[model samples]
Target: MAKNLLPMDALIAGYLHEAVQDAGITYRKLAAVTGMSINRIGIILRQESPPATLGEIGMIGSAVGLTASELVERAENVARTRQDYDLVANDSINEFPEGNDADYDHA
Candidate 1:
């Protein structure tokens, strides 16, 4: 079986789509409920454009009966789990070469 990997943004978008459907809220109605413009709500529903701020996320989560913290944690979890091997190479490491501190200093 081929490995299937999805981006965090796509995962979050899918989650929002499911949450809205489960809550029985249409996108237009959600716009009214959240006091965000239809265009903005469309962007959110599309999931291509994530909520710009924590406040925006709070509004969405509240409408879907989710806590803001819960939504944030879910997004973080998706991001954490979706990393590829390439990301491992970029992770921070503590190893440093030993050298004279005075020689490295330039002023």
Candidate 2:
């Protein structure tokens, strides 16, 4: 399932790493708090296979002082941002700049 997803592997993994960095916890400490192996934690931050379960995700949120819902929102937001970017990129219409539309143009 992940293979078919947007932003691809390292994207999500990289975001996870960024989240940990932003969370301000050492990997070992996070692993200890999440009750998972340092290796498993690495997999999550690294975005490897055997992806984390929802429970693990929740644990990560707790470890980072984020709620599970907030964490999911963070992840979901990545997809949303990508979609927004794509939409803007594909748009062919030019948005008139402020004064450019000052003339009564919309008859």
Candidate 3:
């Protein structure tokens, strides 16, 4: 079975969607500006896929006139206001994989 997405994923997507709207950027315009595909942008904005990668977040943020750090900070602020923020934040940490040296091996 496909794993369910973390609440953080939806939260981030919602934040991005609002930011894009506030910036007056359509998905097509954002795609053109960021050199990303509309389908990918739609997937990210609509929460149809997993949370975006750091690189993708940066691209999207740039298109919306925000830095990646700023975008993430804003998202965290939004998360903090939710009643289940603690549960969602802790769950995200618990779900992350712990890695050792071998996990980063290139050879």
Best by TM-score: 3
Q: What would the per-residue lDDT of candidate 1 be over residues 1-107, giving only the tens digit for each residue?
A: 52222344455555667788898998788888899888876676676544335576678778899866776578777667765523222334233346655765687
Better of 1 and 3 by lDDT: 3
| RMSD in angstroms between candidate 2 and the native structure over all alpha carbons | 11.7
The lDDT values for all models are 0.65, 0.67, 0.77
Kindly list the per-residue Cα lDDT of model 2 for residues 1-107, writing each as its tens digit: 54322243344455567778997899899988888889988877777776666687678767877665676666667767675443232333356666778674877
Sort by lDDT, best first.
3, 2, 1
lDDT of 1 at 2: 28
> How do the candidates rank by TM-score, highest first?
3, 1, 2
Which candidate do you rate higher for lDDT, 1 or 2?
A: 2
- The regions of model 2 sitting more than 4 angstroms off are 1-14, 84-107
- My TM-score estimates for the predictions, one after another, are 0.60, 0.60, 0.71
| lDDT (Cα) of model 1 | 0.65
- The lowest-lDDT stretch of 10 consecutive residues in candidate 3 is 87-96
